[model samples]
Target: MARSDIRRSAPSPRGGKSSKEQPRGWRLFFRRLFVWGFSLALIGVLSLAVAVGLAAQSLPSYASLKASQNEQMIVVRARDGTQIVSLGPSYGKWLPTAQIPQVMKDAILSTEDRRYYSHIGIDPVGVARSFYVRYQQGKFRQGGSTITQQLARTVFLNNSRTFGRKVREAVLALALEWKFSKDQILELYLNKVYFGGGAYGIDSASRKFFGHPGSSLSLPEAAIIAGLVKAPSHYAPTADADAAVGRAQVVLGLMVENGKVSADQARGVDLKGIKFAQEGGQNSVRYFTDWALPQLDLLLGENTKPIEVWTTLDLKLQNSAASAIKNNVPAGTQGALVSMDRDGAVLAMIGGTDYVTSNYNRAVNAVRQPGSAWKLFVYLAALEAGYTPATEVVDEPVTIQGWSPHNSGGGFAGKIDVRTAFAYSKNTVAAQLGNEVGFSSVASMARRFGITTPISTVPSMVLGSNEVRVIDMTRAFAAVSARGKSIEPYGISKVTTTDGEVLYTHEARSSVQLVPENVANGITDLLQSAVSIGTGQAAQIGRPVAGKTGTTTSNKDGWFLGFSSGITTGVWMGRDDSRPVAGLQGGHAPARAFAAYMKVAVSGRPVERFQTDMVAPAFQISPDDEASFSGSPDEYYYVDENGNLVEPPADKTAARRPSDAPEDPAPGPDDANRGGLEAVDPPPAASEDFLNKATGKEKSDGTPPN
Candidate 1:
């Protein structure tokens, strides 16, 4: 067949064109392929658009994001509004983009996103380069997150490095870009980003790292802070100044490359002139703030607004107390002081000398034996048991159950009245009286006086063997100063919101009458004697003061608890590990500290004297008062004639009259009988003693006939 006929038979190769038009068949075939490919590409684009729109629906609304910007800071102040400390996730005032320094903005843009102004939430070219570089490195080495993307991640999304989280972050970034201006996005990012050391914003980071506001930051300072966006803690100037300086240099180099700063300008910057904020020792009231923070939450539940806590702490007194401890306390040993008013308002407290070294609140938390300070309760129990200040008790060595308590100086003072024994801190007399009144009675008496610590019923308890906190002891002593009304120590007087809404006001009132007025007056008289002429003589403040000195066994704890009509102060000095401080004693360092603190604490206060009634109560024995006189025979007795038993008159006044029995000779020094039991007035004469004398059955020795 002819060639033209063959081509025409093959559908004419392009509708009957010549062989020169054969190339058009191939073009037509390619054109149809391009049409199908274009349709598939459009369908794929539509599918991606649908998926992105669905994911964007799950993002937080713009209003919710705006509402979350109110981060409240808790500001704690003393009673006088002196700033003690401020605490929160972010601890400074928020700043707008206009308030931020231009240097900081330039540094951030150069180091983080150079195309921040030109991009719409994302830079495709930067992202592609970042991905290519990451793929070449075989690991995630760089991030392409723009500033807007970072703000979205910070304010709305979790910091998860996954494909899904990145996708969500990108979608949220676009949403933020659509809803807010670039300046608004930048402000949110600057305020919400975390800049280590518990600082969460540019303002906090600036003040924390530079000791100034963000508006005053210099070029290098801004560069250093901008470098922290990559790693805040690792590059924090407070922790490692060298690393932070290096990071700032890197940021400076980037700024130069991005044309934000010239190379000459960068070279003129001095990183050394940038003084990092001095770390530590800034807040002098951390101990007080630490204690008051928990109470803030307790008083105002779930507070979302800024709160102003008006604590009872006196900044002057607190500073003085801390200084007193720092200067007076030994180097190796630790000390704590708590000062409260008659109403149990804790005015000044120093839990430790340095809060930066340790935060343990020894004043509120340490429990140490009160030693002889506990004898106040014992003597109070004795007073309640019908024993008067003139009641005579032997101060010789005495044993109760298996425990024999000796004096601090290991020698008996012989026979002395209860007042003298207490003033001199006679351990033997205290133990004997504790035994006569019962140990449980003394413990109950302590509880009545607001000693909430656990009190054991052992005989040594009268010598302050039981452990107690300084705050508890201060409260108990304050009750005594308050004329026997119970008291509870408090630090926070009121808590209010920044808007003047009152949340709590302390209304402290006595829970119960801890001690009778008569008992309180009597105890006050004895304690006054303690401060005036006894072991607590060092605690005298020229005004009337009542206090007790306590030295624990082995000098493990030394305490001086005292109070005037105006204030109650307690001082404790000891090692934290319970190791005895060499040469430390209650009357030495602790009493000195107490006197030092009170000298300043009560300088301007009106001096008032304690009520003193020296007249002793008339003693009369009642047969129904068995518990008061339930001691053993060797513990009490009546005068005998020729070693024969005889009962005396019931009236104690008559029994005090001259005894008919021959007076014994003066006791010799070597005689163990020097401190022997003394005869006391007895009840009306009974037939049992008369019968013994009538039968001429004389007792051989002082021992009772069995």
Candidate 2:
């Protein structure tokens, strides 16, 4: 600032020598301006040179990174080491130059790179021709992405189809040219391109589209496979056979034009009749894969990219389950099945009534209220809290915190034993027990048994008000069948690289015992009674079996969950529109379907009997028989020979109340309205060993006990 200021202040030099001699100051100023402009120009040239040098030095590395990364693909294999699926960049396999079919090579070269072998990596003639054609079309239509350029874009670059990306691709293509030989780049490109439909490499496409591997493709098939490179879905054999043939014809034309095939040979080709499997299309097992994909992704996280998920799914079991539902469930009814081993390995899962029509996977996706089946948890809570199976519980109508529960049939049996109450699904009894044992305890017990959904500790919890997925409920019941161990279901067993490098392995978590063996056995015994004489009669298998039937209120949902010695199977029937099923109670079609599936699912396996513990506290003459007094309509009371009622002390006065303030009113016409009927809740009808609550004492005269 000071120098410029001084110069400006010094001013324009006007020498007085002569007017013609004139301004020496102006000449000096012009000379200085010229020098400054020259210096800036030299600096600009140096900067450009430096930038070019830096790019030249680092560009190769970027191109190399792209090439290497794009070449490596993550192959997902089954536990048996078979490639079940893959997420690769290419549509085909990476084979040596000689392994690729001559027809396929010729087809790709004739269509994609006419001068692939002649030119380095780029062809200026082709570029100019394509440029002129696109300009004449008034749109950016044609692109001259050489084989190398296409490979570069696929393996290393973003999928931006813009001019800048195109330019970058071209630059990378030339860089690849200088880095590798023509055959090397071609081989890499052939193995690293996408043929669409999740077919990453050329070998996969040949196997998928032609029903043959890359090494076995016929001329016409190879031509078609090569044609798919242009647009896979648009010209896919499955999507449009005629269009694919048309594309093949264009490829054949190019082949002949490039001298790769004779014109007569191309014309004589009668290869227009290729067809693909319609059932699976190019994507086989879409339903099963879609179902397992999210689960696999969640379990393996970053490792899922290359991991294969091998499930315990028996294809036969799946087919049988689906067929059973189709054959039995009424038309317009939707259902699902969850079948698992006693060890918790899910053998088969059928999500919807039909996965083909609906992608809704009801096995794991749909969460519906479980209805009375949830009573199992309430019973489990009581059993764990030192309550024996013979424990007496009143079945009278009771209210819990303002929620009055009605029986499934709208009546109570007064008092009942644990087994009868559960087997009969006495709603009032279950609610009373749920409240007595604490709803939180029941909810906690359900959680320990693998119910992941939120459980509410309300009185309705006893009625299966909690929502649970079919799979979750199946897994929970599997614990009982598994002999008191929790079984977390899993699909994939192991994962490895394509080259057999062991990447990751999934080990089964050891069985966790969440319930005492005796308690679980007791629960299973009670459920066995359900199948034998109670609500789950439809689940009666010839062999010893145990299960529970669940029919939610209003027939909105029905379920049959059961287990044989070997497998636990759950069946659900409902409607997609959420309409009530037509007479579809849990004990009806759902239980029948479950038994039908299990009868075959567990065939040939010897039954392993459930173990029960007798160490539980024994009651005196069965708690259900603590009192017995028969009354008749004639106002007659049949008293036992010993004394008042039954089992009374000698000194006790049976007819006398304590000498208190007031006595109970006598039975009279007006007393009935005054609460003087003296209706005492009778004890559960005790039997010699077990009591039938309905008939007072287990029918001593040999009337069969309920």
Candidate 3:
């Protein structure tokens, strides 16, 4: 061996390596370095294994993975399919793997975990890419979680950035893959994941955003929902529809890239086609939603599952009602209004001027004096007892049970017919009619009218002293407009589960005719006179109106209740504390609000005139009677407790303007109908327990307790 010829001679630069023959040191050094490197790698792998085992010990069992949930949600929708509000965490009915829309599955798979089917719960390639991205970007910018890993995190582990949490997540991921099939994992992830806006599942997200169920989701809708999993709040369709759609666009692009969706299908999606659901925030529709909630218990007996309350709320009318109150009612006063169809389906309701500030629904909740409005029942009772609109009555002061009621004008008119007395809303005449009709009969008439509130059986009740809810009063009037058919105000038409299972359906409490058609006709004529040419002139719209006005003592409460041929509504204005609103009167704020709301509410319906066939008057007003009356044909008289027409005193006022009418205490620019809040027993319908449990069923409008 020639040292000069050997390759070791090249290492002569280091004197020790110059001896090429003795190469063991260099070989030994290389061998030891390799051995140390292998040993460190093995130690690192063992340490990771041990760490993974420790993490596995702390993780929850995959056997317990399930579609967990919190409280059930209640979704209240309008008659026209408008979602009014969602009560709690909304979870749609669970969708089985086979039932899940294929587009949804494709969207999720393409955008979330393209290699999900091929992976064992965790994607090594994805993890490596994620770490590489972090290394390149110098921060954790994106997650590399597979669908299974994400499910494990959302179901079994809390989202955390700690290394131990990551290890535990990985271990759970493996366990989930072992325990669940790919389809099961996908189904679990979709049905249990949060999609923001208190929606916990795809079905709920579909309904929450698109106003439909999971089975009805479109491609765009599915993509939008699928994108929510990454950042629920950031991509919630209800929050920012544009951002959600933008995220959906990205998802669709990924779907197309992954061959899950066709390019043509992706391109055809219209940006304008997608609309996010928005309900119950700042929009006055909250009034109806807030009202219809508690009734669920009475409706379905402590329902806890997700349900849809099919309500009779007309969004159009509801908006109109809110606008009417907010635009017409004075700043310091709160206003409430409820409108219903002839069948008693509540079309719209306004609990207060601003429901956001005050949730107490004055429409169905508050019971106040319905001054002259109570005259409806009294007059109805008189008519029922064979009294006619033309029946003569004295306007003189009358005393009953030690209670003497005077004309609001402070002076009595000479002589007036029954129609005139009712039209002018003369308080003295109403008291006399109540006495003559027999307070018992008057109370009975009110009871038959569906008002269930406590009625003062006292003599003053005839003078509009009964405190009654607006709904009860409205219903009393509704009976008149409906020709004496029983009317019950109902907000919910039906209750159903998310799976379309029917729970409860509303039925009219009573089908029995409470008032005779003739009496109703007579009452309707009086109401027509009150609105057409009488005190209710302020409530008149272009179409015919039959309504009355009511004001409590000291103007503490003002109310106006009216109905057209098809729809009925009641309005009340007052302070929540029962304090009087200065200058408030039924003919003013209430009438104005009623007119404003009806102008929009009925504008879309055909003009249906009220029934014109009024009952025959017992004392028919003849042209000859107008020609020759007993005392100065202009004389307005009053009826005593015995139903005798009493002559007016010499000092009695001859002619009078309606401004000082007792019922409409104050006539503003909106002077016409003035309802005197009369304390009366609520008509029978007001106390319908099944329906009334819904505070909103305070439920029908009134002309009686006005």
Q: What tens digits encode model 1's per-residue C-alpha lDDT throughout 59-85?
A: 566556544644676767788987677
Where does model 2 exceed 4 Å of error? 1-92, 135-141, 159-161, 275-292, 295-305, 387-404, 411-417, 617-706
lDDT for residue 587 in candidate 1, whole number 0-100: 82
Pull out the clashing pairs in model 1. Answer: none
Error of 3 at 638 (Å): 33
TM-score computed on alpha carbons, candidate 2: 0.74
Tens digits of per-residue lDDT, candidate 2, 1-706, equal 9998998777366663334644478797888889998999899768745643454455555344323543434444333444545554434445777998788788888888888877755688788888898889976565776898887787668878788887667666766776678877777776667775656567877766766678767778878878888898788776778888888899888898888889899988876666664423212233445555566555655652233345555665666787767777866888888888866666777777655578787777788998988888888767755566777766766677899999888888766678888889898888767766566656656765667666666568789987888887887788888766767766555555444555546676655555556677888888888998899988877887788999887798999998887688888989877788779899998888887887888776897776655343222234454233121111111112111122223333433234452321222343211211122221122232322433244443456646
Using all chains and alpha carbons, the TM-scores for the candidates as numbered come to 0.77, 0.74, 0.64
Write the candidate numbers in order of decreasing TM-score.
1, 2, 3
Pick by TM-score: which candidate is best?
A: 1
lDDT of all predictions: 0.75, 0.68, 0.74
In candidate 1, residue 199 scores what lDDT? Answer: 79
Residue 432 in candidate 3, Cα distance off native in Å: 2.0
- 1-706, model 3: which lDDT tens digit per residue? 6865787546445555634565488898998899999999999878766665565565444344443555677888899877767778877778888888999999999988999999987899999999999999998776899998887887767887899888778877876676557888898888888999899889888887887889878888889999988899988976888788889899999999999878999999885587766554545677777767677777788666678889999887888899899888876888888888888888988888877677787877787888888888888877755566876666765567788887666888746777888888898778866765567556656655666566556788876677777777887787678887767667888888877899998876544455556667778888889888877889999898889988788888888898985889999888878887888888888899999999888887888776646543322333344324222213322222221223434543433324343421222432111121222211221123312211222323422222
- For candidate 2, the lDDT comes to 0.68
